[model samples]
Target: MKTPLTLLGLVLLTAASCSHESLTRPAPPPGDSAERGRELARRLIIVDGHIDVPYRLQEKLSPEGEPTEDISQRTAGGDFDYPRAVEGGLDVPFMSIYIPAELQKTAGASKALADSLIDMVEKLARTSPDKFALARSVDEARRNTSEGKVSFAMGIENGSALEDSVANVAHFQKRGVRYITLTHSADNLLGDSSYAEGAHRWNGLSPLGKQVVAEMNRVGIMVDVSHLSDATIRQVLETSQQPVIASHSSCRHFTPGFERNLSDELIRAIAAKGGVVMISFGSGFLLQAAQDHEKRLREEAMAFIQQQGLTRESPEVRTFIENWLREHPFPRARVEDVADHIDHVVKLVGIDHVGLGSDFDGVGPTLPVGLEDVSRYPNLFRVLLERGYGEAELEKLASGNVFRVWRQVEATARP
Candidate 1:
């Protein structure tokens, strides 16, 4: 193993390597990769159901996509930039208004976090009206499409944002938050987080938690099962009269031991109920090997970070972390692997239950390499085309399935 080098040193080396590659004239896309990808992206109404953009706002992340004058820029250095989204043919991105779980436990914290998220949404809308129009409903998404604008749907990443109040659910519903994950990295008032045991007062969606699910269904909010416990997931599925989505989860078949993944049985359950499972793009969440590698890298990086005592989320640190990730580069969890997950769900519950929810900015440095950022989605389209996925199947996998479930869930929620 190589001894750890300074970030400055790594940057110098990578700069040289990049120059060398440019000098060598990198290989062109053989036959039809780029063309097919272009065609595929053009046709599909891509929807990324879970992105951490609102989190980026809180963290003060900048837009990274090129064409500075263009309207569609995404977070700088982070994935899902504007030029790239247009290039990838992504039309609708359900921007996550995520509040960390800790906020729910502390009184007033949820409101504070919610206020920040709302503020960010307003800021985005105010600053980039041409690029992003809020998709308050499926009708609004369609309206945005007709107007040739990007649909910006809002979703609360954790039910903890409801903060033990039934009315808070209504508050978020009014704020255009279309979905809510039951919990996050830590268990909150709702239930146990897949990451941390959040059962401080009550674990796994207390009686209030159950009501939140029903309320979400009643209020036209989609129940997002991305971070819920398996029990919580089952409960949500049982509780919601409409189909629920595992908004940004991968298959346990692809990445085992990550409870964040929906099991084969759970996948079947979601599909049986006519719900969709948007595949996640985080390497750590996709392949155990990749995640394990990054885990060690993080430990090493953190060890270095702690030793140096640098600010964790600073630009210098972020640049350093991004460069570090560029090293252990997780291969495109192969579009085939993505298809395999889609196939797994398709076989289990048919085709109407699969969609793409690449956790672009949310996954941070652990995203799929070729699929890095929103712009790289063209690569997935190319891969899918290469895998012999036809147009009809592609449509369902791209956004049709998710849209279908969304319509149903929305219909059931209407007054």
Candidate 2:
């Protein structure tokens, strides 16, 4: 029989062991936490409908005078790079083959620029086959995810690339162009742009624009209405045989009087047509304060250009503009503001019609504070999760909804 002291010693030893075990064992990940958001982001294949990688690179030519941007390695200057994309769970991202509205003035200029941007993306995939592949369809995107490779999908930001001919639509489709925003910052041959101040050349879709819409429907290219005027959006909805997408648009309710964002009526109409509105992450698109700030900056830039008698394209004007911008930077929107845009869409049309476009690389450094780069997607996911979004809703938001629309566009293409 042991003495009472021996029993007491044994009990203390057991207690110490228990304490040691408790200390050594990993604690359960914080409940409903950022870890959960990261896990969800990883498990879900994130298909960002718009990322302007091509246009971003087009402005910077290499010593060889080529726009050969090597994003296969971690890049310091842009919101997107291979490592950051993987970190953020971006499986497929649409590279915008953006043709600026000014390029539309010259015959065949838009088409030429579009072709070059497409070549840039193809070269990226060709050079970095180990890390990137081309995804021409939703199925291809899924295959890319399964193979653990990042996918490049192409989108045209201006329909002027069609060059006043409907056949160019099918030609671009052959080049892997998946969607085309009808117009950009200004009115073009296709239609009036939302930002075309006092230029409602075609109050809605031009007669040619209508034909372009039908041809896009026949060719299975998603019609992107993000930059179209309100009248144009309504016309596209009435004309297209299939669903359309606003590849990088936000809710106008949040930034009232901002024509770039879709109105509540447009949101409902898009949902009615079984389409999705991929929210843009640009600060100006998500908040009125940011929009107001941007307008003030634009005015300041114009005044400077006029005062200096310098053309807008002058290098000196650009330098002056950069200096002015540095002196008066726009206020950054918060991740909460992005959540509010998502929430507004959900409340207006429910979850199936919402997705993320982010406008990544295209939006510059003006992105919201916490949601600044590709690696920060989990931050948005956490915000949504905290707001009571479940796994299913997040899955749709990540890729499923956009995939469904892509498949539908494919299945229902008239030609």
TM-score of each candidate? 0.81, 0.91
Tens digits of lDDT, candidate 2, 198-311:
659989999999999999999899999998999999999999989999999998876789887999999999999999999988776777766656566566667776788976
* Residue 258 displacement (Å), model 2: 0.7
Off by over 4 Å in 1: 1-33, 61-76, 197-203, 294-332
Give the best candidate by lDDT. 2
lDDT of 1 by residue, 168-256 (tens): 88888888888888787666777666666323445456788888888888888888888877777887777778888888998887566
**lDDT scores of the candidates, listed in order:** 0.70, 0.81
lDDT of 2: 0.81
Give me the candidate number with maximum TM-score.
Answer: 2
Instruction: Give per-residue lDDT, candidate 2, residue 277.
Output: 96
Any idea what lDDT model 1 has? 0.70
